[model samples]
Every structure is written in structure tokens, then in C-alpha cells.
Target: MNPWVRLMSKNVANICIMLILPLVFIIIWFYLAKSIDNTVILPSPAMVLQLLSHPSENLISMGSLTNNIFISLLRVLAGYILAVMLAIPLGILMGYYAKIFQLFNTFVGLFRPIPPLAWVPLVLAWFGISSFATLTGVERGILFIYLNNIKLSMVFIIFIGAFYPVLTSAIYGVKNVKKTLIDSARVLGASESDIFFKILIPAAKPSIVNGMRIGLGVAWMCLVSAEMLPGSLSGIGYLITHAYTIARTDVVIAGMISIGVVGALMDTLFRIFEEKKFKWQRLIR
Candidate 1:
């Protein structure tokens, strides 16, 4: 086949896999919905679509929705980013250092049992219904999601989580790395930082990206629940709650659809990052 034709074929296949599959399922869902006739509880796909067609009657025009959503998005983003930043470094350190793992493993064991929601009252009790409460509330909140989710969150609480796996695999990936490469650079007297940015991270990029991709998905899934905490009036979670109060099932469904769209968008962005930035780290093999 011509190169252009081959690429087009691949693109078509990807479209089918990524989009058509969902559409097929949705068609099935619509048919089933019509058969059930329980529009009150499980509205038909058509009903939901009709609801979506209705103009949004938001009370708080520009800033209200923006502020609310921004507040909620910021909270979740802050929590997740803090997690990725704090956890990855700790994971790297603990994975490399046995002593660090032993020291922190006990704390992980202690807190791992607790649910994030369990911290809500205490967070409110201690921090009140202000910003601080919402933020720290999630340190425990997003933890469980990322905890059961991927190795990154687990290691923050303990040593062996992703620490060992990531560390050990990283070491293995590095073992194959030519010793002479680092030795030559060291013989040239490159600073430790140079070696890390130049060698360690690049060499271990594959494993690192895998861990990150998993963690990102987990964190995104946790967004709605994390926003369910009090004092957040902007996110899709808050929107859903607000709509439910007035029995606006359409709005509630719309909020949920928005959440789903955001989740899918995040996933798509991650894939784009993987394809563009981390092509070398792609785990296709």
C-alpha cells in the first residue's frame, strides 16, 4: 500500500476502536432504554440528549460557574499534582534507599486502612469549611483512589509499593545501560545533577511513564468524589448536587456527562503526551 494509504488505514482503525465501539454500545443502551420505559429513574438516551439540548439556566453567570468549576478543578488538580510531585520523589528515594522504606512503611500501614471520606468530618472539624479543609481533606481523599490505583500513591504511604517495583525495574533498565557511558561522563567530571537529568531519568523513562499514566487515570477517576466534600460549589460534583436539589435530572445527567467528558479528555491528553513526548517510553512491546 502507499504510505499515505497505510497511515490512513491505521487512522481509520483507531477511530473505530476509540469511537465506534462506544457508539455501538450506546445504540444498544438506547434500545434497551426504550424497552424499559422507566424514564423517571433511568431516562432514555434520547431524553438525556433532549435535556442536553435545553439551554443551561445557570444563575451565577460568568464567574459563578467559572468560579465554582475553577475552584473545584483547582482543588482536585492541586491535590493530584501535589500527590504526583511529592509521591514520585519519595518513591524514587525510598525505592533506592531501603532504610527510608522501613521508616515510612509503618505509617503507610497505619493510614492505608482509613478511607478518604472518613477524613471529611475531621478535616472540617479541624480546618472548618474553608479552603484548607478542602485541600488537606483530599490528601486522605485522593490517597485511597491512587492507593488502590497505582504504585505511585502506594509508595508514598509505604516503601515496597511502586518504590520497589519502579526502583528495581529502573535499576534493571539501567543495568543494560552501558557502564562506560556514565563512566566516560564521570571521567569527564559531569556533576551528579547532569548524570541524573542526562542519564538516569532518560534511561528509566519507560517505567516512569507507565507509573505516571496509571496514576493520572486514578487521580482523574477520583476527581468527582474528591469534590463531593463540603465547600466546593463549582465542580461537576457540585453541579450534580445542585441540580439534584431542584430535581433537575437533566442537569444532573449533564453534570455527569461533563465529568465523563473531562475524564476522557484527560485520558486522550495522556495518550497524546505518550505518543509525542514519551514515544521512546511507549510500552508497545
Candidate 2:
């Protein structure tokens, strides 16, 4: 069999096999819902599907389900992009320059372990009602007035959640490039700019991709948590919270499922790009 054909067939088979577990899970979920006798505690898959089918009607108060998802996606993209922009350069500097690494190592070490949720209170306090009102010159204590502007707070939290993973991974990736490779490029009279961009970055592509994958997941999680907090009126997390408040567990479940599906789709796209971008690595292997 041709190698490319075999690879394609193997991937298809793996996907088919992987799908079975989710189907099994759905079956178990259906059985559990039937046995539990409480729709509020655990809505059936059918009930969730029903809500999903008419998401506009079900989620009208929070805007349509599509709108909520779009809002969340925007937040995730904004934060993740910001994180990547800052992390990549800083990571490269840290990895290539010992002084830079020493300067940031202690700070990164101290804060990297802190959960994104822990920062929520601080974020809210900084960018919440008071901050918004102050910035916009609106009088304080006006309810629902500054709610929309709090999107920045959510974006920042998501950035914090995503930043460290990419930074650390990128730093490691750059550092892991064999010193001999750099030395070789130097000996060949390649300029520092050429060596760094042409040699270092290409070699670190896989690690950087891995970091981005992880960071994207973390960014999504942080977006949800941030949106669930006070002042958030839109996004999937807000939809979930609103549904729960109204005893609409089905909507909550649907929202959760939407997050998972969208996250998986984004990851799949990223993986495809990674594969195409680094196809040469496979040939080398």
C-alpha cells in the first residue's frame, strides 16, 4: 500500500473508532436520565437536543444561541491572540538570552501555578462597575449601565489563563534547538536575524503548535469562567448561568455541549494546519 494512502485509511479508522466512545456515552446518558426520574438534575439527551433545535426560542433573553457563541468566540480569540503576540516574542527572548530568562524565571515560576479563576475577583474589581463608570464618566450605582464594557475584563482574564502555557512551551522549544545548529549557522556566517528566524523558529514549530493547542483550551476555559461572573450578559457561560437560574437544565447542558463541540472543531482546524505546516518533519522522521 502507498504510504500516504495507508496513513489516510488509518486516520479514518481511528476517527471511526474514537466516535464509538461518544456514542456509548450518549447511550449511558440516556439510560441514566430515564432512571433518575428528575429532569432538573439530569436532562435527557433528547431534551437537550430539543432545546438545541430551537436555540433562538430557548435562549431569546440572552440573544440567540448563535449570538452567545459568537460573543464567547470573540473573547477567546481576542485573549488568545493577545497572549500569543506577547508570549512568542518574550519566550524567544527568554530562551535565547540568558539574562532575559533569569529576569522572568522567578516571576513565571511563582505565578504560573495560580488558577485563572483566582484572578477573577481582581479582574472584576479592576475592570468592573466602578472602572467602567469611571472611564465612561457614568455615575456610579447605575445598574446594568456598565455591564457591556466589562468584556475587556473577561478578555484579560482569558489572556492571563493562556499566556504562561505558550510562553513556557515556546521558551522550551527555542532552548531545545541543538546548540550545534546555532553554532553551525553562525559558522556559516548567517546573520543573527537569519539564524533566529530561519533556523530556530522552524525547528521549534512543533513545540510552539503544542503550546498553542494547550493555550487555546485554557483560554476557552477562562472565557467561560469570566463570563459566568457578575456583569456578563452574553456568551455561552452567561447563557448557561441564565439557564440554570431559570431551572432550564436542558439549555445548560446544550450550552456545555456547544462549548465542547466548538472547542473540538477549533482544535481540529489547528491540528490540520500544524500537520500541513510541518509535513516535512514527518518525512524526516
What TM-score fits each model?
0.68, 0.87
The alpha-carbon lDDT assigned to residue 208 of candidate 1 equals 61
Compared with the true structure, what per-residue lDDT tens digits does model 2 show for residues 123-228?
Answer: 7887663323444555646332433434767888889998998998899999999999999999999999999899999898788888998999889878778787
RMSD of each: 8.0, 4.1
Using lDDT, give the best candidate's number.
2
Q: Point out where model 1 deviates above 4 Å.
A: 50-70, 132-197, 282-285
When summed lDDT is taken over every stretch of 10 residues in candidate 1, the lowest stretch is 151-160
Report the Cα lDDT for candidate 2.
0.85
Model 2: per-residue Cα lDDT at residue 161: 90
Query: Per-model C-alpha lDDT, please?
Result: 0.56, 0.85
